[model samples]
Target chain A: MRRQVMDWLEERTGLETAVNHFLYEDIPASAGWHQVMGSVALFCFMIQILTGLLLAFNYAPTPGEAHSSVRYIMTEVTGGKLIRGLHHWGASMMIVVVVSHMVQVFLWGAHKKPREATWLVGIVLLLLTLGFGLTGYLLPWDNRAYWGTVVTTQIAAKSPGLGAQIERLLGSENGVGVVTFARFYTMHVMLLPLLTTLIVGVHIYLVRRHGIAPAPNDTAPKKKFFPGQVFKDTVAIFIAFCVLFALSVFLQAPLGRLADPTDTTYVPRPEWYFLFLFQTLKFFEGPLEVVGAHILPGLAIGALAMAPFIDRGQLRKVTQRTTAWGIALLAGAAWAGLTIAAMRSTPPETDMHAGLVDAPEWQSLSPEELAGLGHFRKQNCHACHVLGEKGKAIGPDLTASATKRDAAWHIAHFKSPAEVVPGSSMPPLTLPERQLNALAAFMLQLKPGSGASLDSAPDAVVNGAMVYQQQQCGICHQANGFGMKVGPALNGLASRRKRDWVVKHFYEPQMMVPGSTMPPYRLPKQQLQDLTTYLMELPARAPSRD
Target chain B: MLAEDSETSRRRFHLGVIYTLMGTIGAALGIPAAGYLLVPGSSNRKEEWVEVTNLEKLKAGEPEEIVFRRNRKDGWKILSEKTSAWVTKKPDGQVIAFAPSCTHLGCAFHYDEKHKNFLCPCHTSTFDLEGKPLEGPAPRALDRYQMKIEGGKILLGAVVKSQES
Candidate 1:
């Protein structure tokens, strides 16, 4: 029955013969493993298209919802993480395969004579692949992607005549916002994909027309493309997919905190493929940045496009084409060398905001101290002052400021910045007295390891109460006709749980209760003890009438 | 003739094995893709009544601010988020709860005893004791959450998005 259906369909559509002609080809026996890179690239692109379409169903492109939508996909949608991971890793794989394919084609002298148009088309494909990466990078709308795009568009703006216009077009008039996101999303999901697919069709047609370039010796036997070559390509694609699957399972695609345009502390870095260009910028300072950013790169691409014409050599063997091969090898080596050097020289981005938040120093802060830190961040003080590894060095480094000056000095400086430092550009703070005091306290606590020893004074209880209020611990734990009921009431905590256990729980709550949702305080050892002491003493107070 | 028939049968078996292997691979990929598409709609948050504070803590004709934490189960992750509400007891002893967010820009608004009004620091939006906007950028009254007194405890229901604000 299936054979009859197939025969009828074939007779009506003439599909069988057309498909046969499309699939079958003749090639040199010498076309071996190196010939498989193009097929592998195509395979990765197909994977990208499939996974990308799935992701697009759930992705929101607006600035407000992009990050949250991605978060939903990762945490709430089953197998969403796997699909996103494949798409993410597949992008890098595609670039790798395409670059290697280009390099192999170049070395084989396949771009010469009859295949110049094919070589140029391949170059355009390379650029389109890069375009895919650049546009897709911003779709996540995380801090890394936002800031990386900012730097790239700024680089684009360094062009001589139409620089500013390009910047304004890439970035909206008000800067990266709804308009910018919409533009990038359209290019990433629609324009670039359509353009790439069309170009790929043309590229394949050219390859079929020219056929695979034979080895220089021309002594190998001919082979049909169906069983031998197609099998090799299939194996290469399967191996590529296996590698991508393993990577996706083990290494999750990074999703940094949501994009905050106001956050200038974030250090922007591009993906590894662009590291060579990024490192090149460091050598060319202010005025000459355009040279490294645009001119040099443009010249390199121009040279590559003109290579076939410049050489015009009939020799395809590497031994006979010493000059061309040497130049290519040197360029490749330079890029690889620069990439390694950049990787080693630049500190890891993970350490950029360390010791500020999500670090031991931040967790150890008292409630009042934390409030002061919040005020500092809200006021954008980091834009000028250097705080730990964060912030630029435009103002004094505040890491050791506490050791050099007292709280009173900080208060005075905040009230009158120009009086404290001659010709200071900092504006005088006009916060309420309580907030100013909190800010001063926070600044004074910035000394290295200053809060390590919590002195148990006669007023330790009052300070502990302030810590409780600052941390908003009452939000979960109820006490004295106050607080919420999320956790157990602490009205008589001294009688309920052991003091030792309470102190240990503060350090690591999971150690006490495996499934407890209470986050670890991660406070200093002495502060933990003080908090436990305060909890133990809660029952001493008489119950207040409602 | 018998040898020829056996050879053809062996070839048929090999072809069948290849077809099965291909089908297995396709199913392995297609199942996850289908699951990913369907799972998000099934994984939705179900509202439950959560205890905010004891009714005894509130006094007649006075508003008290209460902050709490709630756990949101999103697929495999249980995320704890801090939430706050302003609880007020009327002269007749009826309870009311207003969400802490301002109507203008969603900033957390706090009651200022000195000013005798709820104020949002972000845009200086102000609301009265009855959760009505008094002045500034607030477009309407503060949003309210459904509440009830259960077993001497104040229970807050799902937050209702105010259409007016």
Candidate 2:
């Protein structure tokens, strides 16, 4: 019945030939199978548009109600959870699609010669897609989203003369509040989507006009677009939608917690795609930091935009387009490296277990885990849990713990801490099996080694540490002398905390800390873990904390 | 030979004439278009006895709403309805209307009765009871209107956004 109706509409529109004969008649259906990710990405965007509209029905952009209104959508409105899930995952999938699309374009040298316009349009669409994600991110009014936006927009202020003005234009001069929320909301839902949609249309139109480049073959004629090309495209689209539907349904997107503007304890990080840029920002000093973070990025974009006009070359083959290909990969790789380095670089106290965690504020430490940390801290865990005199005073601080204690000893020690040592204040951790593991993970890696900070510039290390200090990262993820009582100490975080765990915590601390006094961080993952690693190195003796 | 020479001369003359006409037309049309597109059009408007509005909904001493299409660059465009703002009338029957736009540039001023003046927090520009410039670097007072009542509803027939005292 659906096919008949669709066929009727196609006939009425005279699109039967266009859809069936011109686009999809001859291409092998199976060969286009792997373009599913792109199809899923595009469908996810459509889903975002639909669900976003539904969310807009209930979402109030005013500062006071923004957070609560989103809560209402999530908990009260019909299918609000699904809508939010679609929006969040749609954003993630869009990034994935854009990356995949760019790779395809590059590997095929589609960016060369007459197709530079197509490449340029694709670049713009990618950027607008990311921009849409960035601006809309703050709309949810969650901790990571809000503060992450705040941190990202501050880079706009690095443009020297126009920086502050652009920042004010993007956000209200004061901060991300009612005006900012409304503005970001408009850009996200209206302006950005419109711009992206228009550009995406242009990208598609150009691609269709100049059909897919034929591989180096001798005899076969170019395939028409109808059933030949679009069948493949449609099949690709269907596979992609299935993956998106699976993601949206089976694994609901991560909406960790609401943002607190005043609570600076949590570190915010962007999605994985943004990790490279976040990492790239860590390589410079003060002004250089600005260039690396914001200026060069803008220039790179401007260059990409101007590519059609600049690279007056006649190359079409992928081999001939090697220079451009290298540049594209280099750009991606550079960012990835910086991000990895940034994630690995921790300042002084990346130690997860230290006396640096004072009082009742247990930050990154989970609730049941907090009970364990509290037990350890109440007895001055740092003084005793000494890893070469860096942790507690009375006991052995964890080092080579994975090797030394191994999984069995670690589990046994947590179940009976004094069993590890006679005078250990670490009491027996008696929780359900899962939480016991989380706490055990927290406990097993207590050392004062630097996290990712070892790979970063000293100044960047200092700046990240400074941000940590100003935000009072220690309030939760504590360093040595400076920090609050929420999250556990960062000293020895490198040796103890897995990089993935630290990054995840940075993405949403509450996932680690329920009933967490520590706010979820909205900083990019690279920045989050950079600061995390810095804190990991703080040994009750690190100089920065002092 | 003579016929060929004459034809060539005629072709050259036609080309010169077309080029001259094209050049002249472009000169006449292009300058103002470029200016309008690129430059901020002169925002100057003097305080004249402009019609505030003749509408029944408008009441004396109370602010009323008025809206109409504005002739912006392209053509008459539909302005946002919210841009139709509140303007307080004066004591006399000839109503004295004040633009809700703040005196320090044209941002919508929130009426702060507590402070007894309109405030623009962008640079802390303030205006007095009748939209007189009270503080800040505003060049002049908020624009006022010469209003009259007509029918049962307030009809804002004509209004201009400006900083005329």
- Cand. 1 Cα-lDDT: 0.75
**Highest-scoring model, lDDT:** 1
Q: Which residue pairs in candidate 1 have backbone atoms (N, alpha carbon, C) closer than 3 angstroms, thus clashing?
A: none
Q: How much does each candidate deviate from the true structure in C-alpha RMSD?
A: 17.5, 26.2
Estimate every model's Cα lDDT from 0 to 1: 0.75, 0.57
Model 2: residues >4 Å from true position, as ranges?
A: A1-41, A76-78, A216-219, A306-325, A345-546, B1-165
DockQ values for all predictions?
0.13, 0.01
Best by DockQ: 1
Model 2 interface RMSD over true interface Cα atoms: 28.1
After the best TM-score superposition of candidate 2, give how far the Cα of residue B4 lies from its true spot, in angstroms. 65
Q: For residues A345-462, write the lDDT of model 1, one tens digit per residue.
A: 8667663222112223433344455457657766888787645434554565464345477778888988998998889989999987767777887786675322222211223443
Candidate 2's DockQ is 0.01
